[model samples]
Target: MKKEKQYINIFIIFLFILVSLLMIIPLVRNGRINAYSDWTFHSARVQQIYLNLQRGNLLTFIATDVSQHTGVGTFLFYPYLFLYPWAIFKLVVSPVTAFYLWYASITLLTLIISYYSMMRFSKENYVQSLIFAFVYMLVPYRLYLGQVVLGEFIAATFLPLVFLGLYEILWGDLKKWYLLSIGMSLLVYSHILSVYLSCQVIALIFAGYLILSKISIKRIKVLLYSAILTIFLSLPVVVLFITDFIGKGIATTFTGIAIEPEFNSVIVDSFRNWNGFNIGLILMVTFIIGGVIVRKNKQLKYIYVLGVLLTIAATSVVPWYMFSNTILGKVQLTNRYFSFGDLFLAVIASYGLSRLFDKKLDIVRKSILMFLISIGSVFIFYASSTWVLQETHTYNKELYLLLQPKKKNGVPKIPDRVQLDNNNYNYQFEYRSLTGSSDYYPIKAYDNQSKVDSILNQETYINGKRRKLIGRYNTNTIKYRISLKSKSRVDLPVIKYNHTEVYVNNNLIKNSRISDRGTIDLTLDKGMNNINIKYQPNFSFYTCVIISAIIWLLLFIYIVKVW
Candidate 1:
């Protein structure tokens, strides 16, 4: 029995490797790289982290080149967990190769984690576990997401682990609470929007478990502990996001006019937009078949029901507009809920296959089942390979050239006379600039373009003054000398955050404030005023980071010892 099990494991490992290779056929064929939508942007973010580390900055929050060199807190608002591995890979390899390596690692990890998670749920049913993990990895919607949205792909990859952990906590051992904590933390770290959607699903699962099974105080305690631990582990990133959101008033107001459209159109559009390959029908049918097959298993039945409901909710059936106008708008998309649905459907399909391959089955039936499985496997490979090839070809033809690095002789010298034009400068070529948008920077050119143009023609001027560009300027800090002809207010073109501080002639300016356009407004005195601007995080940010690091270290030690 042991030898047979070892052989099965070997075969499964081989199968996993074969599938992984099939998935990467497009990437291997290209020899170049896949610069699909958002790939360049994400790659650039990883590059920023690498550059920051090279500059001796450990905790990098500000993107120096964003907002046309004014800098923006990109990492401050975005999750950094997924980017860390890619950034580390970039240290030893080329950026493009590092990206591919990151994707490959993630894909492999997804398969391994899913397979293990399924094994935990299926107990001795190793074949069923293998099938579940394989199906989950190759789910068409997930593959489609991998090509476009990486964060969602990562979050989706871990969904099975999260569910398995949750299941263990609710229905299995109380000692496995740590699994839930780790899973929840990983999900939160991978993507903030995913975290929000995942919380809703978890809540539904918890409620369903309560309805279906008897709960004990011990189980409740485990659940609470897991929740608390998850929050504690993710506190640093969560605090940073909340602090930035509150500082920016992002949730209070809607920038655009809210238009109410017909309900049917909204639902149809939502489904159409998210369902890349119309895989919803296959998922629905498989889920029903699996639910029927696993009707006796209470746990599987609950999962099937959860999947059906989530799948429906992901469509236009729910009043998304209401949620969008309210707190749920922060998530930006209701369709993301489909990922959870897909996960459940995959589990159900695995159960159905397990039932079909039961020992009691006749030889003829077993042969037919094996043949059907073979055909399905071939179809999945063909479909996935074709999809990847098409997507890669389309991306290479269109976006690959745009992201290609251009050779430069040397750093371009900054012009002595800097123009504060209201017209948006295209920063596509300005790789050094942290942000591509100019909306945050405050300038005098909005109403006085002619005046700004006149000043730009002069030997030394930004706002009708002889301002000498002095000192070293980088993403985090800017230093310049303003030889103001007279005592005048000099507005520095920089996006203002709560932590942005300005100092003139080595003295910190008390009343330095952010303008309506999100730039720093500095009141200057006559004579050569040495101006210095810096982005400094608050005490809370430091405290959170230190605490988070300590907690993570302790968790790592505990996990190592326990495992």
Candidate 2:
């Protein structure tokens, strides 16, 4: 009987994973969707890395490059940086076939974590578990922003494990503390944003556990031991965190904190323009119902209830949104972090409905009908918001046309270089000969070396006639300059505190005052003139050491307790 039940559990997980894959199958066969800017950047980065690998260019693969949209240099080699790695199989396998494989892998991992969570929380059946997994996987924003927009599909896989670890540490078997620690550590490696949000959620759960778990020395030991073990296991991620934090110049990065956007616009950007993808109504309802149903199961109730309350508070009430934005100023406020609440809300609603039906209520048929309707509402919302990537036509049709020339030979005769001047500075070249192809020539021009802001005062001219430059590039190097214009300026350009010199004609332009803009007026020679600007972030010795020590101490305590 026991073995039979185990087999049934396995079958249930397999079925849930299968259902999840079916929902996202459309992504498998399509050309890229025109959605989030981040998606395009990540995809391009992944392709660049793969190309470098093919060409044996390890140094180039690791170098940071300025992101046209962000105006900041990005760490390209960050693990989970992009999704195109999975897409490469499109060369050999049909996209539809490839998507199924990718979807199955992502869902199966989610299912394992969800199953473990449910088992630890309640004696639920296969149908109940399946319902929870389905709802969790189908949240519209996650479907839209995470899976389709950011190609942060890997985040969905990591989060479930984080919760599973939390469950083990808080309510499950004591010996599993080490396992829980490892789960938390793994989450850190997946995506830093998700990890940060999870930490907030976990803190609430920990507080609840401390208050309600019949506090005893033994229980304290379990909690602390689990923490210690978790930290010890997180050593790898800790090293990564330190390396990335220092390497990226966190002090300079923090300057954006002062200019973060307000909450109103964040809501508009994230949900108001949902076009059916933002299912805020369905999320609210599901969470409320789930909260009521799970009240008896204190452990289960705490997470869902706290998650809902905190999500609402963060996005609306408490300054979590404002605070996080202010703290992370310069970063746009898109409430993807609240996505974690969506999964738990759906799980609670599904599990509650499943439990309500199990009671064999006198009005069984009516109750089941109501439950089905409620879940169906979510499905409807999901369908309405779900975006279908337009795959009927590819964007790089022009590139393919250009490459047609190469079909007759070994390589395409791509333009190796081009020249431009301020009078006729704009240049456009198609690497491929596709007409109206958008993908072959994706570029963004940066006026300065930083590449952090959009170009507001630049004019383009192609072949001695004015034309809009298709994209932007740096004006720093002679190779990059391609052309030169009038160098004389009436007012100096502002230099950010983090950057040092603004150079013209290989000469350093100094700031006249501490707050003086770093603009310079000069004239360029008719031919090629090299212009370069270099920025080096100044780090605070005291701040860095203090933060470093605090993080280590925390990790040490967590590991020792878990061990």
The candidate that achieves the highest TM-score relative to the unseen native structure = 1
**TM-score per model over all chains:** 0.77, 0.59
lDDT digits (tens) for residues 503-526 of candidate 2: 555676565222111222234445
What global local distance difference test value does model 1 have?
0.62
Scanning candidate 2 in windows of ten residues, the lowest lDDT window is 433-442
Residue 506 lDDT in candidate 2: 63
Residue-wise C-alpha lDDT for candidate 1, range 1-563, written one tens digit per residue: 67756665665666666556555555645444433444444555676677766777766666554322444555666667788888888788755456666776777778778888888888857657767776776666676667556778888878887888888888876666788788878887787678778888888877767777787778888888888988888887778766665656322212222333333553443334232532333454675466677779876777787777777666556677667656666555555766888788778887886765675555456445544553465456455556445544533333333321433332122221121111211222243321112222224332343432222222233454434342444647767777766777665555566677788899998868654434566767778998777788788888887887788899889878986
lDDT of 2 at 244: 37
Let me know the TM-score candidate 2 reaches against the reference structure: 0.59
